[model samples]
Target: MQDEDFLRRPAAPQPYSLTPAILYLSSDAVHATHKLLQRAGRNESCVFWYGERHGDNASVHSIRAPVQRSRRGNYHVEPESMSEMVRDLRAAWRPLAQIHSHPGVEVEHSRYDDAMVSSRRILSIVFPYYGRPIANWPSDIGVHEWQLNYWHMLSSADAMARVRLREFADVEVRDFR
Candidate 1:
């Protein structure tokens, strides 16, 4: 499927929004993410950094946590591993977001996700797997951000507008792989 196909997919009944506004990702990062999620099968999880946050825009850099086996529909990051990743990334770049895949499910934040969000300002992305081929991975990418004591799910258009409200209307998704 094409990139536009992702937007055309039906929206889930959850809130999603890009907290700061804009988000950027490298083609390499996107490709690797697809591969990682595919290898993870359904319900498995992987974690990554949204790179450095610059004002209302951020870039997705690399995978901090590789795909790991877990129970159906659940994946947990070890506390120690998470702390180490945060420490290492914070030395140079802050952890801006975390991306995970929902195998055979729509992209939405589960209660588990909300509970795990902690108090940090981070963008949580859910990629729809739905048992589709890897080429069709991320068929629908859900973007969510915690704000006003809730996780708001923003449509693609809304996300773009939010990111562009204060800056230029033209938002670019550059691949610096």
Candidate 2:
């Protein structure tokens, strides 16, 4: 579709619920995601993750979708690559969520994004990669959970706060020096 498809805002707030209770992200995983989005600039970039979800905690361990140049754009993921990535990741780790960057500051899900979530009920995170990367992330991120009909965008503070809650207390972030 149009280049700004992903940038558009939704018409109305849709019903949604946070799934898996807790999400634990590794430092390396966050770093790699930031780097990929930065390199892509205004264009959209994404990464998938494989993790273990037990009761209320989901421990994300590794990145399943690597940066592939074949589908570099501001609004879409290459169909072929996406298909292959999902297939490959499903074989090993459960596809927990899809992380992407927005060219603009708006972090809400667009209509296109809602349509994309048609059949899959997964978590979707939109990062506002506007300025310099910072050490803190809870203050500048968008978290959305797919419900039966629509995606719900959680408040940035709430999302971060939830992640920092006791459920994700034992996460380990590996330092790549």
TM for every model, in the order presented, reads: 0.68, 0.72
RMSD value for candidate 1: 8.7
Error of 1 at 156 (Å): 2.5
**Tens digits of per-residue lDDT for model 1 on 48-88?**
65466777776665455532444446666666656655554
Worst 10 residues of 1 by lDDT: 168-177
Can you list the residue pairs that collide in candidate 2?
none
List candidate 2 stretches off by more than 4 Å: 5-20, 66-73, 86-92, 130-136, 161-177
Best by TM-score: 2
lDDT to native, each model? 0.55, 0.58
lDDT of 1: 0.55
* Predicted structure 1, TM vs. truth: 0.68
Candidate 2 on 48-164: residue-level lDDT in tens?
A: 655677667666765654435412234455566566655533343565677767666666677666665423645787777532265457657677775555577777655874454
